[model samples]
Target: MLRFFFVLSMITTASVSTSGLAQSSSVQTAVDKNFLELETAVVEAGATPIASIDHARLAKAEGVEMPASRVLIFSDPEINTPILEENVRAGLDLPFRVLSFDQDDRPQIAYTDSQFLKVRHGLNDTQALNTFESKLLEVLNGLDAAPAPTSELFADYGVIELRSQRSVPEAVERLSTAVMGQDDTVWFGEIDFATEASQQGVALPDTVLLLFGGPAPGGVAMAGFPAIGLDAFCQKLLVYANEEGGSVVIFNDIAALAELHYGSSAEPHHGLNKRLTSTFRTAIE
Candidate 1:
């Protein structure tokens, strides 16, 4: 019995690599299916969904290595929701790609039409689209180089939205000037809930402030690669707020983490979480 068990274990081990990594095709298929499934659920839940794809896989499968970042944001509202459900169960994967830079000094993946098609179909193609793409690449590389948002940048054009019950002008004045260094700006709005609280009675404010930037009520901000953004933003907000009062409901749009690659809010790094908490502690105490 012992020899039989040992032989079985050996056979299993022989079929797997030492690193325990699944075959690239298997991993790729799994990821593609998972993302598609997630998209379907999100749409069925009545939320608008967007997908960001990595387009370097085609070249990689053909023995090429290239560095590319391409994300696709689209709306398929006209498609029946049931079609989406059928697609998920059928394991039909979206035509998408993956990107990575390698040590061989070549791009890990080659650019291909399938990848570009997703982007072309999704974008509005305004002249600014070119500028935006360039800016996004710069921001991603910058985060890899120096993981911290320039507060001064926020001081220049960043906006803040306060709750209706709170005084708006004062909040703006206090927050706008408080940001030091980078040229960031602040804009203000008020969220007003009606007495009856009907959806029509309550207007969703156009401007949202991520609490990680100022206060919690307006928008959620997060950390990590672009893929995990929503989760990271929500996590940091809860960490900073710590079940506190409503005074800090406004937010400043600190750049996404990809823009700030090196530091954190805690003492060792320059992140929004640490900076906001530090500011609050000094003010409250």
Candidate 2:
């Protein structure tokens, strides 16, 4: 019994050490990279970093504030402005609402937009949603309006996906650091991922921040589902970004939302195809 316990204790110690090392490594690497340009812009706008953002005006609909999770839906597919469409297609999904909460798990604000809401009614799988999310974030995270596509060899990203297995809070911090740079002017809205779950009537915790931005020039559009209907969305976000200099739109529970809309009775695949084709033409046209 003594021998067995000794072995077990050694194993436990090693495991703890490994876990700590991994976490420390993650933090160190994250600290080295740049991310959230929009958030930095908002702060540089001379507004308090934690100012009470007008979520209603930003999101264009009614939104609610909840604990660490909030959901804001963009329902309208047609109301997308040219800039919004390009940006959305470029991977800036037109955020329509924001839900903010406090560290004590208290509700803060629920803001929504009428013009931005458009029922997805499509996209049923995590794979599809992942592809969509990856494409959009690539553009938003770009230091320039046109950041090059990621390479597959990148530790956390490739041509289309930028994922970090780090904790949600940590990932957000890293992204925020990258974004809040000198001369970066923008605003941001925060919504909890749990808000998305609640909206879908499910229970899930996926931290996602939907970013919107100010306009300087129109960016190029890529192909695939990300390309579809994105022009409209991007146009809206860019306009918002240009006028306000930045916006913080939040999202949680991306998987649940993808499943809800994609699994619905509507022809999800067809919708995706149509959107993709339309995006291609819009970009070229």
Candidate 3:
């Protein structure tokens, strides 16, 4: 039996609720703000804005019509390091994100709640989680947006895990190379959770996260529902050490994400799920 430290059942189960807490919080802005304005807001809040994806523009270039939508990825090392020190898996949600989109002709913003992250990754640092959540909320409140009720967009997001014979670093390298080799995908970058934890004077097993996306398929999915980008846009694959002297790889289940954001009738974007599974399988082998 593989002694995975994290709860495999919790991650694999479909649409699991975070004990009644909404997975995300959304608000409608009183005034319209462009993508650049939103990005500036995040930067001015003391978080380092890492990247922004203009899903609407990307879809437009592909001949798909999508409302104005964008996702901003940002992080405050001071806030993130402490939480990561408690549970390295929290890296999966770090470099926090906010999604802005046009809904009913009104500009709206949505972000994952820090409480959701604490539950999703089984984090135990109450102080750190509270601090992170407070900072994020401060940024959203500054936008002059009327807060909407929290939403449980998905019952629970699903995760796919693959056991690898190689070490964590080796598996990460293999997966990164394989993902980058595909012409349809673009490699965004990576986050080294173990290293970040170490910098905070905490010892954690090797863990790394690779961010990449297939714009063609991802854009199509966003065209259907722009809000899905809040959770599923930039695909992430996590490689982490296990107690058995090997490593494990994990990523979001595209099919589950589609059903979570879209309805059960939704299908994985253009067979992208199958291709992603195949890529990870080969990388692990």
Candidate 4:
């Protein structure tokens, strides 16, 4: 648990996004079966269904009826707390959900990948989060006869360590400028984590999470892979006082994160892979 934090930090104000239950485009159609069987099985699998949304009835009430669209939200404090305890923004992905609906009169159930949280929340290491996802998927698989969605996928995110020859603020300023120069859509946000700690009388070095992202690729990234929303918007730069008395700059590996979430298609959609590769070099150096 603490291992993942080395990169994401204590997870407070810097929080933004994480898409739990990464959905697969492959699950295009619903299965012709009883939704109750799935529901009961989900409970038996150890995850509680906290809420259910009947989209068809709700839409019908508005006089614009639709198919049998139902959404089930799950709650497992054991599965959710590890993420929420670190960053509250993760609540968006919480109550973890599963959607069951009549698509063309066939019933379909969907589950998202938890790894999305690791990328978006700034978790440096993903082993713990990936493990939880695997457990959740195994439980869910027991509920449905069909195969459960892919839960465990390795995303090799690269973190560049640039030994800043200047002051912390100066290095951040240069990096921010370079990120923006590459593309105006790339913007930045900064949080003074170390300053907050010093206020509590705790001795600490200068530490900050320099967050950045813009519309150029973000909108396109999500447009291609809606799931990438969790990974894209949260791109950032981490600067802290190193033991050597100088500051070290760390940032999310765009290519690694994009490929992880979008999988193979990431290379062509708006040329994300190529763009990210160039940016990594530009942003870090």
Candidate 5:
């Protein structure tokens, strides 16, 4: 119980409601000030600020080079609880993200559509999910924007379909224990999608997002290649009903993510990548 409280405090402190809480980099981008302005603006929009990771500073400190970058994750638990009640895996996209970056002197801001997040995970509780989309747009409009982006979110994810030998709760308990059993630390948080949805006057299949990881493995990988941190901070165990109504888990393959982040299969990351894939397999099987 103490461990759970510590993890919550750790993540939340990095994303306080007040402005100026962000850990930023010295490298400036044209759009940098916009994000600073957004910190306050996002609050006015009624969302809970989660955390912000400055990839540029994080990478530079680890002896790697990256463009000026910042990623912000925010949520309105009041809004999310109702939706997540119906679709637990929605947590994957919960606490939506807003990103700012400078490339070749041009600063740009980007965000993922909550709808797109559901599509990638194969969730279809459209009405409930739309609330997440709308809330995200509400926050984004409070700031500034570039042209509408056509790119998909989580394009690097390699999903796996595993037949669940145990129920969602059983799987989660097993996986959580496995995580703590690891020599290095790992932390996870779970959400009850079905119950949350039922409370919202909707029905959804039993679904869950078992999100867990630690800074050690992902951080080491980031030191090896900082860009991967953008996508690899945490890996998820998505337990949901497939078309047949049987339970299965869908997750992002670490090896695939390494390949995507490195842009063309860097053999150097093969070792960590394999270990990552193995870890997920052990939890589910």
Candidate 6:
């Protein structure tokens, strides 16, 4: 039995917008549970655990050494459906994830703060967001973990967007092919927001999300700070239809994200960022 201690840090005063929302975007929590234990807790809380990524194992396979780190992607449609109806962009951040990593020999867990999601997505449904927050808290509390003092690990969300002359579907297919064409890249899966919304009787513009990453760059990034895997390991590209019927493609800026997690934008990150930019640009063009 492996025992891990996670420090849960909730940002109470971090504000992303000047609208007085008074919410932060990220939270780190401490708990006495391992990765599997945490996954079970998520399922017991009635949320669906979609994927679990072991960053340490991936690094090992790539001949890189890193501390133990993993990320679990899960979702609760009941809590997210309403929010999605309000803002479909939230799909990029949805299927909530919790990261477990060993830092300084002390294991820790962190997750995206729902209140921050509310502001990030411009969601107006307070009740739905509150419910989402409570449901996450329920999972943590179920582990019998206590909250600790907050930390300043929060950073501004950064993404690069590209306009596509093609339609959303065609752009998504092209982007998928482009990503897979890259050396060492892996296409995890895609989420179609428009299809999901249509099933729920809500109309939304064509929106699709593509998740892909390679151990070479991703492992290299995590070798610096394993926690970065929570956000940067699984690279995401969101393709959506614009008002003009064309498509727009967006993805996380690796340089900005690397700086946010590793405290500086190193040369490796710059190279990776350029590579990603070129790949997306080629697909859309």
Best by lDDT: 6
**Candidate 6 deviant stretches above 4 angstroms:** 1-33, 142-156
lDDT of each: 0.27, 0.27, 0.66, 0.47, 0.56, 0.68
Clashes of each: 43, 69, 3, 5, 4, 8
Summarize candidate 2's per-residue lDDT along 16-78 as a digit string, tens digits.
357645653343223222222334433443222322232212222223221122222332122
lDDT of 3 by residue, 107-212 (tens): 7677777767766677778899889988888677656333212344322246677898899878887887888888767666677777766776777788887777
Residue pairs in collision within model 6: 6-30, 6-31, 7-29, 7-30, 8-28, 8-29, 8-30, 9-28
TM-score, per-candidate, Cα-based? 0.26, 0.27, 0.79, 0.43, 0.64, 0.80
- With a 3 Å backbone cut-off (N, CA, C), the pairs that clash in candidate 3 are 15-155, 15-156, 16-156
Could you give candidate 4's per-residue lDDT for residues 189-229 as a string of tens digits?
Answer: 34555454445444445665554544444444443343343
Whole-model lDDT for model 5 versus the true structure? 0.56
RMSD (Å) per prediction: 21.3, 22.9, 11.1, 13.2, 7.2, 11.2
Better of 1 and 6 by lDDT: 6
Tens digits of per-residue lDDT for model 6 on 132-228?
A: 8888787776443322111322322566778978999899888888888877775566777677667777778898877667776787866666666
The reply for model 2, stretches above 4 Å from the true place, is 1-159, 199-201, 217-285
Deviation (Å) of 64 in candidate 4: 30
Measured by C-alpha RMSD in angstroms, how accurate is candidate 6?
11.2
Best TM-score among the predictions, by candidate number: 6
lDDT of 1 by residue, 1-285 (tens): 000000000112224564423443344444344434434443454433333333233223334333222222222222211222222110011111122222122222211122122232232334433433333233233122111223423221222222322232334334434432223211211111111122333321121121111212112222123222221222111111112222333333344332432233322113554555454334332
